[model samples]
Target: MEKITNFSVRIVQKYLPSAFVLAVILTAIIFVLGITIADQGPMTMAGYWGDGFSKLFKFGMQMVLVLLTGYVLAMTPIIKNALNALAKQANTPKQALAITIVVSFICYYLNWGFGMVAGAILARAMGSSVKVHFPLLVAAAYGGELVRGPSSSIPLIIATPGHFMEDAIGIVPVSQTLYSSWNIALTIGLLVLLVAFFLLQKQPKDIIVLEEKEEIIETKVFEGKMCFSDWIEHSRIPTLFLGLLAASYIINKIISDTFSLNLNTMILIFLALGLLLHKNSASYLNAAELAVKAARGIIVQFPLYAGIAGMMTNAGLVTIFSNAIISVATIKTFPLLTFLCAGIVNFFIPSGGGQWAIQGPIMMEAAYNLGADPALTIMAFTWGDGWTNQIQPFWALPLLSVAGLSARDIMGYLVIWLGISGIAIAGTFIILM
Candidate 1:
């Protein structure tokens, strides 16, 4: 076990440099382009970076909500106890993996933020007995992430591409270009992908085996625990939690409402709530600190990505790429093409909203010209944005960092699932087409 732990540590150390280097190079390239070309002006690069920095607090608030949800769920005694029971009931890697996937899926469907929390709580509740097989435990959480789909991707699934098509072109296409049909195909594809992943995962031999050593168990004994009081204290914050959840829903709705005024309202509400719930000065300070920590990942990363996207779009990179796609792609191939393009772009632009902002215009145009379903085009984009996340380093960072693991440790494990997801998405598109 000591050897295995050491090996995992080394792998983490090795990967950290690579991840950091990639981030720096990507950021630099984008900034250079924004300044030198793209006609963004001399101050544009600085403005982009500054704007990202300023929004750090808002980003941090989102992160705090994510962490708090996860932390609170983990802290629940019932969940902890349940995990202990499960660990004793099913002792092997296969059993644990199955349980993890089911739990993750349930949690994810509830809400990705909360789902992550629930997964962490369950994993911790299982205790040291389960941690004896750390790799399996980690894999379980990751499995959930893949199965959950992207948060932003969900919106595209329901949005009528027809609306965008009308704006892009004067006349609507005769056939539904890509709405419900594409969704159905993608759903079926994802189901098959999940099955394949399950089958492939049955063989534990493929997993990297660390040198076995003596197990070190850490057990927490709950003796004469104040069950009632604990429950009340924990549940006391539900008003705040529920209020936040509702606000989140409203914020999402307002952002999607097309009236830009709602964006300002949403921001104001977020700030006010942060201040209100913060209580005393010390607590408020703490909230502020937490918010900063939470926002770091998004704030640091988003601008560079946005700039890259801007450059690509301005330079006609997407037009050039999409044209190539159109040259060979037939009307019957619309669904597949949409999926492929969405997936490819997702690698560079990880955010669903961000990707849509850039790719949506071009895609809508294509759908109108080709006599395809606009809704189907949106679904294709959704599939592409989500399917690649399993392999994308950006989204994996938060989860991995929280789990005390690095990308390299899990990257190999995700390879099969990523391929499976891609095929499922692509296949769905083809079927719909």
Candidate 2:
């Protein structure tokens, strides 16, 4: 297995392009496919791409906030000290990998945005001292992002009352989708499998460890006579009041049971905590500027992926692709088939919500025709969106940036996880769903 992993790593390092290159290649492929296979005119395809390019702007902003807030929160003095303290617990490489995976599992299961950066920070903390396989530790941390957990986008959207698909599928409650027995079992099972797969990877005699740890610096005092403007800039009043204000809103929502873990809500949760942690505007903004850099690729690439989704939608490529596989599914096999369709489409449109936007209608209609459970189909789609992330570099960029690693450095290992977990997911859909 170690030999296999090393061989896979060598292959990926040799041939795999960066995430940006992958996006451009996907865009060109989608364009050509739109014209040839989808039977759309080139001009029509271009217009579809243009019109649909910005459709994801709202979701894109939410994603950026997730990265931004997560980063800023981690940079706070209290958070940094806590992470450093926690780093002391994992004294060995194996312990570091295991503990990072467990921490990531809990964080990611609770909130994806929080999990995205939390794992990297924890891994970095552990790597600062432990002679661990740094890339492997980071990969283990990132591997826990099932994307189908509490912060899942598609499930929450479909469960919402005013969603676009409501007329067709009705407002399916979270109990039927996210909180269902099968989904719970599937999530737990996948996490266990990831832990097993990642931990079992053979460690090297000379493991990659961080040569230099990122120093957490104290915010220094102003050198000159502090002016009124300087006082305002560093004032803790705004952070206290505004952070508390955001906290109050979240508290009310939680108490009232009205809070759903959608993108905006997740951002607020992170923001409230981040502002409180950073203590003042200057500190928060400085950390924010650092966080914003992690999200730069997300800002650039989301539009390209959105354009791909637009072309797929307008050119009827979504229907074409979905119906092609869905055509063969029997009533008993519908859930498994939907999972497969979602996994395939996940390659082009990496976001679960975005994938659903294009492929949901087709699958939902087929579910009705085949008499399959809509909730099961939804969860299946969610897991499919998640399963491919093992090899998908889109979500890994921020985590990689934080860990100071590249996609090629870890994808070889992730590719192996992709195959292992995919089978487990497919089996669950087949046997249980």
Give the top-scoring candidate (TM-score).
2
Give lDDT tens digits, candidate 2, residues 1-433: 7888888988998999999999889889999999999888889999999998999998788778877887788788887777678788988787888888888888788777678778888898899868888888888998888647667888889877689999898988889888889778878888788888887888877688865746343476878788888888788988988999999999999999987767778779889998887778988888887677778779889999999999989998888889888889988888888887888889899988888888888899999998899899998888888878778788888888878889998888888788888888899888974
RMSD each, Å: 8.5, 1.8
lDDT of 2 at 180: 84
After superposing candidate 2 on the true structure, give the runs of residues whose Cα lies further than 4 Å from its correct spot: 213-220
lDDT by residue for model 1 (1-433), tens = 3344345445654664444456667656666665555556646655665554433344344544554444334333444456567667657555655566567555654445445545544444433444334444555565556443333332422333444334554332222422245444454455445534553443333444323331122222346765865444334354456446756766686788742222233334444354334323333344344334433565566555665565556555556666777777777897688778877777766666567766777777777788887666666676677667766666655454445555666665565567656776666567656
Instruction: TM-score each candidate.
Output: 0.65, 0.95
- Runs in model 1 deviating more than 4 A are 1-18, 28-89, 124-127, 131-133, 146-295
lDDT score at residue 400, model 2, on the 0-100 scale? 84
TM-score, model 1 to reference: 0.65
